[model samples]
Target chain A: MAEGKFTQETVSMTDAQKKAQRSRNIIIALVLAAFVVLLYFGTQAKLGANILQRPL
Target chain B: MSVEAIETKSDDVLISSAMPGDYYRLMKPRVMYLVIFTAFVGMLLAPANINPLLGFIAILCISIGAGASGSLNMWYDADIDAVMDRTAKRPVPTGAVTPDQALSFGIILSVFSVITLGLMVNWLSAFLLAFTIFFYAVIYTMWLKRSTPQNIVIGGAAGAFPPMIGWAAMTGSVTIESIVLFAIIFLWTPPHFWALALFRLKDYENASVPMLPNVAGERSTRNQILGYAVLLALSGILPAVLGFASIYYGVFSAALGARFLWLSFKVWKNGSENEHYGFEKKLFGFSIFYLFAIFAALGTEAVIMRVIG
Candidate 1:
């Protein structure tokens, strides 16, 4: 029973570490994703004339 | 706990050091997503409506195949990835996965993806999938990468094959339009990559991969980037001229191409260390958007036509 508890504690610590790492990853990914979004929409907006074509 | 059990736990830690999520990171899932998205667009535009299930199967297989290639790349390049900040935390390099495990995982994924694609999609796409794996794994990784500075340029062919494979999956034959898609990516790769090579010169040099920056010097690399930018700009016009795409695509391609050319010119004209130009990051990031937008345009046009009909 004590050994089970011990392993449970260890696993919890590992899970905590994993959660911390995931948070870091999400932040970095969001920053990069934001940059990509800006570049994509910014360029599209710049090419407004071509993109706004209505079969002409 | 006994000593043996402790050892076993340590081994477990070594085998999966970074957790399951690391698997996605190591496989370069984002890159695979972009490749699959473009390939899907190609398939959708190919004058047919494939069963959505079958189309999904083909795309998933291609994605897995792309991931398999990435796993193998990480396995082989672990030493270099260990140091490069851009790729340092890959499963193998970070000790989440052993080299042997990664090798086996990659091999298994390779076989599984190809067989699944062949049985679910067309055999032609299956064959192309197999060739892409071989070209990247054996030709690029084993032979050319260490030996030539033109590694990425030649190896770019492996990546450039995806849209063609997608078209073949739908139509069972290659066409001028598909080949032109291949050509645009083929020409764009060097300039896109060389810009990053300029920024990360030391990491590549430390890894001894003989990238253009290390072997040919920044000047030659920049000039090459400029040359490729010009070629890419020209190739961008072919889709519209050939009547495969609309004038809208042509206009957008021209704008994107002009911007790409300007970035290349900046990379060529300014010194590498100069932050005034903001050349390096702009080219690296914009190149990705350039390919995606072009492919996205193709997909959107096809959707518009389908709706109108």
Candidate 2:
């Protein structure tokens, strides 16, 4: 993460980077699950053409 | 991806060595995650379902617009970003991406995303997309950020627009439901960022960015953090009380929200700012989870409602 001194978020080899990375991974997993869960809604019978219809 | 890589490499060098990471960095992926997640919730809660393909397209456009905003922000803030520890190594300031290139790239993608949404969803969503870009890059970054201490507090409306944008993409109209989502995030921003500002206080001071820590004493900032935290905590309960959410959503939101308040409480009472342990910093870290967890819960509730109700 360290880009050097001239930039923001000094990519210092600190413990913080490792932690932030782990947190980021967990977030990615959750978002993926949300995406899968959302997919279930798309397949519901009530969805129908309403899925394609623009709100008028 | 390759093109983005080339854009970051100086035109001064004949053959560019642009990496996908450069584009990722330029997109400000972290902010984009929150933007996309909130927008996803809005789409889920819409009165109608969007076709999965179109839904995907709508999300793509929103994400692209969000990326465009990041690029524009990076383009404009290269100077201040150079000074701040958090943003110094960004593609633009790091000489990885050229400013003019970023500007044009952002504008083009902004247009593309807005147009795509308009064509696939509705003009309302399209218009909102256009507005979000202008608000984030122009209003928040250009006008408010450096000029005021209340920057994130007020400028936060830009970030708050996501769920509304998502709702528009699906329903092509706005409603109290969407607006309430907007208000929740709107109110949530002050405390979220203020907590961040508390720990990164020195960064703002060094950048002369006029964040709350620079303008308000740590005491006043701490008080404000607590105040906003309480507001966020209360707002979390609204989905249930308004009869819009199930007991599950209510209980879960409240629980996560209370933890949020607890963290803010720590920052309020213990963020004396003179100590080295930096508990306020820890609160700031967890606060990201606080927001993400609640929003994720909202998304989960929507899915459950769809499946069972």
Candidate 3:
């Protein structure tokens, strides 16, 4: 269908758009890092010194 | 058909202009955040011992599933979304993402999230996650949204399922605790959405979305909101009553419940078709906080108890 054909066109990103994309990637990376940090602390709190124990 | 012919034939040319940012927007990141938080609370409140890495993976899958549902909803609702001022600028409507692209993106993500969750975590939660997507995309977005005034009332079950899914991710089965969490969200959504509908009645009217205020009249909507708020307040206290949360949580949630009810009453008494004050908006905003704070209290207490006990 022409509708599907319409969606296949490639887009050229502008410099500003590239910058915005980079910023979004950075924010996503930061959020992932925060999640890892929270997970580490939570595991530590829950497991105490046994945090590194293997899965049962 | 020539490319030139295609370009000149329609004013609304469906171009593929979607950047990564537009893809992110397609996920409805704000709603995704709320889903993540509530699901995280479900993870915390469960009695099973989940490994840290697996828990993280489960939460990630849940987030992706939520995102998938949002994208699918946007894809299906693009018609009305283009017409309604509130949603006119959404990625699909604005042509940042074509409908086909959005639909493909959603389907792929939904399948990926479900399979990944099932393989990495447990199958029960994955099943719940898949059902949530189907319910939201098909039942709510495709059917209930345009057909019924009680759309959000029944469709709220989709949102309320995340916590239960998270709980299942941990325990591999649902429990009373998770059901209580589900009930709280399910009860809260009617008032939360109806209040927003009160303020944005024109938008719904224009979209022909059958939101409560547009269908039931403001008085009936407000009365229903008050009624739901009462049930929400009671549901908010069940964790403490069932012996999972602390008395402090009981007291805090009860107070929040009372405030929520009072605001609902204010909205009911003062809500008008012509006069647009901040009362309904205030209730809408507080409704967000009320959910977040209630879940936060529950999760924090559970975490502290895990550390201390």
Q: DockQ: which candidate is best?
A: 3
- Docking tier of model 3: it is incorrect
User: Compared with the true structure, what per-residue lDDT tens digits does model 3 show for residues A1-56?
Assistant: 11223322333455555665577568769866875675566556546777577787
The residue ranges of model 3 lying beyond 4 angstroms of the native Cα positions read A1-56, B1-15
Candidate 3, B154-270: lDDT as tens digits: 999999998999999999998899999999999999999999998898999988899988887989998999999999999999999999999999999999999999999899888
Distance (Å) between predicted and true CA of B82, model 3? 1.3
Q: Which 10-residue window in model 3 chain B sums to the lowest lDDT?
A: B9-18
Docking band of candidate 1: incorrect
Point out the worst 10-residue segment of candidate 1 chain B by lDDT.
Answer: B10-19
Choose 2 or 3, whichever is better by lDDT.
3
Model 1, stretches more than 4 Å misplaced? A1-56, B1-18, B272-277
